[model samples]
Target: MTYFPAADRYREMIYRRAGRSGLKLPAISLGLWHNFGDSRPADRQRAIVRRAFDLGVTHFDLANNYGPPPGSAETNFGAILGTDLKHHRDELVISSKAGYTMWDGPYGDWGSRKYLVASLDQSLRRMGLDYVDVFYHHRPDPETPLEETMTALDAIVRSGKALYVGISNYRSEQAAQAADLLRELGTPLLIHQPSYSMLNRWIEHDRLLDTLEAAGAGCIAFSPLQQGLLTDRYLTGIPEDSRIRTSVFLDESALDNQTLARLHTLDDIAKRRGQSLAQMALAWALRDERMTSLIIGASSVEQLENNVAALGRLGFDQSELDEIDATVLDL
Candidate 1:
């Protein structure tokens, strides 16, 4: 089928600058972490990607180790880009990260310049692109010198392999250090990607946004739905098709009785506000203006629509916020 994006995409999605950078990203971005693997149907993946672009979602986030087989997500996404989105390359913001273990050998993993460079080359080949709009370090490497990782990212930008560089899962102090090093190299940290949601709030405790704001970098949150714990799908119990049952990332014990009670109470609150728990979770994550965007994963077009529709009601009354603060998990 011939794919033509909707003309009103720009009008539908609101864009925000990444820190003080000249680039702007849509408020909601799509993640290819779980659903773009080779195990999933190709047509369904294409449908989800196409629908996301039609709804004004211009950013698609990926990583070298996203798929079950490690590199299949980038391969699958590349296929879509070559066919459906071939001419729309300039209209999209594509990002991929390296740092996780893609192969067994020591050189195949971590933030060493050798790994970062080779991994991105493989990624560009997989995506069939000359360069990604944004390239990320994926996660902080424990053993690698901070200077080595930041310089690798800077070198990537200079080589025209990535337009901007970012870091993920970094704490406040680590982010600040990376920002300082990148600044010295003249490629300021563009953004930070971290886990944030009603249930998972480590970024708040670390004041990561404060670090990014101080560094003039933007922030994008991942796992805003808390691995399906914040959605109505788990209110009664885990469905057969739920990630808890089908995937290894989430443990089945996470849906224990106490957690189910918390989920129900949260659902009640969302219903009073005329939104589903998933929608409320997303809106809650984006309530702070400092949160530049969120990356959500969807297995179907309907799920993508439900997640993107959250933008229609991003604001929360003080009382609603207070109620949320009082009711949410202490974590």
Candidate 2:
């Protein structure tokens, strides 16, 4: 069957400019970190991609080592693009990162010029795209010279392999340094990807948000749901098939009695606000104007639809905000 995107795809989505860049990203972006892999049915993955686009999600984020086997997610997303989204290429903001262990060799990982360049090439090949909208160095490398990594990213833009360059998982100091180097190379940093949620507020405590604002770099929060902990799925107890039980990223012990109690309290607040826990969490992550977007992963199309609907009720008065701060912060 042919995939025809919704005619009013852009109507509902709110797009924000990515820092000082000319690019704009949808408030909610889809991430291929979890479900879009070989382990999942191709049809199901394709449906999620199609449904996300229909709901006005134009940014699709990926990393070379996203899949359990590494590279499988990009390959699967590539197949979906060739089959269903090839024509809409111009309408999409596709991003891929390199830095984590990908291939086994020494050149397969880290922030070295050799690793970053080779990994992005492999990523482009896997995604079947001539270039990605944003290419990122997955993390800061302590051993490699910062200049080498930033130069590689600048070269990637110059070589037409990526439209813009970004960094992920970098601390405030490291991000500031990287931004300075990219500026010297005449390629200003476009954005920064970080793990931020109500449960994990390191960015706030570490002052990374202020650093990004100072650097004029946009921020897109990944794991905004804290790997599903902020959702209602764990209101009573962990499901047998939840990520905590199934994936290494989250542990069952993370849902301690204290955390569970907080979840219940937050759930009550969400109910009073006329939003689900997940929706409230998503809204909370975007409450800051500094947040350019929030990257969300979904296992099912229905779940994706429900999550996207969070945009419907993003408003919150001082009392609601005060209650959230008291619950999550005081905890």
Q: What lDDT does candidate 1 reach at residue 285?
A: 95
Error of 2 at 300 (Å): 0.3
Error of 2 at 69 (Å): 1.7
Question: What is the model-wide C-alpha lDDT for candidate 2?
Answer: 0.93
Angstrom error of the Cα, residue 278, model 2: value is 0.4
Candidate 1 stretches with Cα past 4 Å from truth are none
Instruction: State the TM-score for model 1.
Output: 0.98
Cα RMSD (Å) between model 1 and the true structure? 1.1
Task: Report lDDT (CA) for all predictions.
Answer: 0.92, 0.93
lDDT by residue (72-187, candidate 2, tens digit) is 99999999999899999999999999998988878888999988898989999999999999999988898999999999999999999999999999999999999999999999
